[model samples]
Target: MGNFLIVSAGQSLREALSVAENNGVDPKAVLDMLTTAPTLFPSPIYQGHGKRIVEDTQAAPFRQRKIPLKDVSLFTKTAQQVELSTPIAHLLSDLLRSDEARA
Candidate 1:
């Protein structure tokens, strides 16, 4: 099984919650629905000269060019340069644990 799945940008939290409530789904189930559904908000892109675009495009085009999460490699030398936030650190730790478990 894959370690992670990319969600598109068409699903909304309200819709997810409604589905969960109607289906009596668990928290994980709700999370799975949210993760699998398209994103309701658009990702922001910053251009030079203080130009920015928000939700300007659909995620379908990008979704067509997905890379497996398992293939993501840490920059061994420069990973330390990134600020370690609680959530990001936890995700990295989880990925490492998943890899070790698979091995």
Candidate 2:
């Protein structure tokens, strides 16, 4: 399985601010990254914590012809939860480059 960090948006933002202060990086940059993450990463809404509905049944009340299934959206947790890859996390640390390193 691929390594992933499941974190709430609030927690991630708080951590980003803390990391920026601790590592001398710009917090605004981190916030910008967070804002653009969805477009860049295109993560699917994980529905592990959402409600489930079983459509298949052994018996039905009436006999009907099989019909094409329509698009059904499942319940998912709030937008607060996010799943980030480890490589992206490493890239965040790379933002803490010194002037000499940038040279």
Candidate 3:
């Protein structure tokens, strides 16, 4: 949910909401919908140790490549273009870039 909050402030979400608003969708109504939606994860973990950690370590390099930095950069770029604030997203993106394990 917290991550979603960050994502919701990112470029992709900013662009999407702009489109929604252009189509007669009210921004406040969209937020209200979210407030009314059922919660899927009562408690969510951002980082988790999965069952195959040992096995997964062998493919760590490949795994890192699979994470979409392109999307994140694009999101940040679009946020700037749209004049929307995305501090959290930008922070996450910066952290992602610096993490050698992820990079």
Best candidate according to lDDT = 3
lDDT of 3 by residue, 1-103 (tens): 3333433333333344447667898744443443333632222221111111222433422134224445566777777897989786676576556653544
Enumerate residue pairs that collide in model 1: 8-38, 8-39, 9-38, 9-39, 10-38, 10-39, 11-38
Residue-level lDDT for 69 in candidate 2: 8
- Candidate 1, which ten residues in sequence have the lowest lDDT sum? 45-54
Q: Write the per-residue lDDT of candidate 1 for residues 15-75, one digit (tens) a residue.
A: 3444665687653444443344364322221111001111222222122222322322332
Model 2 residue 61 lDDT score: 12
lDDT comparing candidate 2 with the true structure: 0.30
Candidate number achieving the greatest TM-score relative to the actual structure: 3
Off by over 4 Å in 3: 1-67, 101-103
Task: Pick the winner on lDDT between candidates 2 and 3.
Answer: 3
Model 2, which residues run further than 4 Å from truth?
1-7, 37-103
Clashes of each: 7, 0, 0
Evaluate candidate 1 by giving its C-alpha RMSD to the native, one decimal.
Answer: 12.3
| lDDT for each candidate structure | 0.32, 0.30, 0.44
Which order, best to worst by lDDT? 3, 1, 2
